[model samples]
Target: MTRSRTAGGGGPVALTPSERAERGKAARSSVRRSEQARFEPGPDRPDPVAILLEQEAARVPELVPIRRGRMLESPFRFYRGAAAVMAHDLGTAPHTGLEVQLCGDAHLLNFGLFASPERSLVFDVNDFDETHPGPFEWDVKRLAASLAAAGRDNGFDAAERTAVVLDAVSAYRLRMQGFSGMRVLDVWYARDDSADLRAMAAQGGGAMLARADKVFAKARSRDHLRAFSKLTHRVGGRLRIAPDPPLVVPLTELLDGGGPTDLDTGLRRLVDTYAQSLAPELRALVQRFRVVDMARKVVGVGSVGTRCWIFLLLGRDDSDPLLLQAKEAGPSVLAPYTAPSAYANQGQRVVAGQRLMQAAGDIFLGWERLTGLDGRERDFYVRQLLDWKGSATTEGMAPQGMRLLARVCGRSLARAHARSGDPIAIASYLGSADTFDRAIADFAESYADQNERDFAALADAARTGRVTTAEG
Candidate 1:
């Protein structure tokens, strides 16, 4: 397949619009869109359980069982935590090799409502732990497969599941085509408005509309104040984080000889390093707050075992609390297959990819490298713990609502790709027909079947004591 941009040999020569379009069309000769539409397990697929265990080697030993238990919940849950498994399989799949910064784990649940820097709710990809540059189809496949898994989890019949997957692929294809004809700045500026999503949900009638309204309302309340009320309490006249065993515990409680002094000192150093990563203006804003209490917060299914810490800071007083999350960042699951990142730190890779793909990002987003209390150095990206963030649970969505969510996610993915990759080339590759769309639907159903088997394998592991699990 032809590369989207000129290959670097000496100096680069900019290709004309026609040259770019022609190159995109030529890609179809080597990588036919129809060929990529199916999924079949290769004969030499890696053992899913083995791959998962390898990942656990670098994670918190105590939390590894928790991550496993979360994955054991259902097929959909398994899919969410098994990004490395899918990356291994995607390597064997046919592709055009059109690269884009992927939300490597672009599952439906990863798309959510969060306030922009302007305080307006915008729907976009929220997680970047697995962000990397790779074949654009990998992200699409992940999203489509997620719909199928989630559809089954929600008890939708096969027909309803098929419809949802198809709708999402069609939205992605059509949106890419629209982006192809737009100005570069226009494509960069494209964003999913929460109001527009609400209007779309309204078409599903009163019940669906009410659900959407409730979700949005809940998202609006996920600010620092809301977090403070639930996570903090007055301890000897000082506001300190409340203990929530297993999931939310003060850092001092987890470490050997760990106490307030040690916790505060380490956190203060982390915040100082993180502030230097930010833009000078933002660094100035951060300097106003002093670190108060930091805690180990077990987050999502995929992130439960990682080193995730939430640092509490007060801007002026206890009334002006700010919470930020310092999440460990590692090599992208796709990194093994794709080229190595140009950035030195994996956290910087995540930050750079997020900046390139999102229309806008958290004002507090930054990265740092530090040695933990265990004395092992790791990279981490930091951002606001809750900036009016809201996400819809798969358990509650109706088929119609799932379709709407799929469309928005598809459109958001397109927007993200258009910003960093060649939209014209991708759109030209997708074409105006249903060939690519139908093919993804086929792949999604097939992969969904594979996912069930993988899920069953993990369940067996848990039952046989091959893997440890705890109540999620």
Candidate 2:
């Protein structure tokens, strides 16, 4: 299975499987698995609140409070919105230099079930806003720490949380071990569809399998039509998006009595340019539908204040509806720590990284750069607004339930990293022992403690009126 292929940089160079394995062994010597357990905040660590404040400078003024409020809800919620803070902390940490496209904010909630190009429910990393190439362990640590924080939110004691974190790290170690020995294309094509998930769940017990089935059924039910019905209504016999205010605001309300077409014209232009980024088939498929409606949409915790929008199109009458979301793509949160993306447009950076890491991506996935309604140029990546999307509930999850979910998440992350990284090297470094898993589990507990202190900083800022916050 040894073949010459370039790993995102330089020319193709031949390296035998054994050579790759030796590279992994060398990395282990440089950074021992037991050393992965070390995590302690330095005295010079940046102020978490100040980092949030700096981050909000590029976001919409009115929406910044909403972002703060969401982060203020809980430590886990804060963790969700505090990717920048974590990025800063990670800067001071050590890494193996085994690079992969990181799910820059690879928290537990970021992993979910979505419809693949083949229309099957594939479980994989669902967020890419902060994705970039960096040390593979960064993403793993992100996921591991998230489990610890979420466990606290769900009332799990320290021991239970550590055990759950171990389940994820162990699954990742074992899965990478398996991938290291597989053929390259075999590793590239590997994916965990519904059947794979069900099989894995079956071994956990009937209760776990039933829970997985429930999540699968829920994902299967959420398609474009379902999203259209929930988010649209007839206004003067013309379909338009229903305003949920703050969270979902129609573009008309933001126009300030300006000409109706001014902003709509800008959005249409965005769509036109976005179409160019798609394949000829998708471009033709998209041209068949007229851009009917578009609105400002605040999505996800960390992405709340970004320039996110939802566009509605109809073809072959109202029954045939397509909803696409154009989300603003900024620099990767890991950009400062690793290296700047080679891409000029942030949207393209996201698209390229996503295509490299995900088993499958949305068919309509594309990117465009446009002068927005504010007369500012912005980068955006477009995809379906909603298509068979669902996630496992972390709140109130039992210890074993979390452990089962962790196994799925850990393996899922490994599969993603394997696509873009040297799996043989990584597997060799991890070896066949639980040493790496236990070390990471220890790091997770320590990081979770640091996260709580950061959460308290934000809380204090809100109480002192140092940062404005609003109800979501």
Q: Can you list the residue pairs that collide in candidate 2?
A: none
After superposition, the stretches of candidate 2 with alpha carbons farther than 4 Å from their true spots are 1-12
Best by lDDT: 2
User: Per-residue CA lDDT of candidate 2, range 1-472, in tens?
Assistant: 3444677777677788888888888888667899999887878888999998988888898998999889888999999999999888876687787888888999999999999888889999989999899988889999999999999999999899999999999999999999998988999999989999999989989988998899999999998999999999999999998889988888887775466675678788988879898899999999999888888999888888998999999998988999999998888878888877889999999998889999999988999988756678889999999999999788789999888889999999999999999899899999988999999999999989999999999999999999999988
Clashes of each: 0, 0
Cα miss at 103, model 2 (Å)? 1.0
lDDT of 1 at 90: 91
Candidate 1 residue spans exceeding 4 A from truth = 1-9, 256-264
Q: For model 1, how does the per-residue alpha-carbon lDDT over 1-472 read when each residue is reduced to its tens digit? A: 2243546675556666678777677778867888776677877888899989998899998999999999988999999999999998996666786788999999999999988999899999988889999889999999999999999999999899989998898999999999888888888888887788888788888988898898889999998789889999998899988989799988768764445564456667888889999999999999999888888989999888898899999988889999999988989888888888988898999999899988878999999988764567889899998888898788967898899889889988998888888888888889999999888888898999999999999999999999999875
Model 2 TM-score relative to the real fold = 0.97
Poorest stretch of ten by lDDT in candidate 1: 1-10
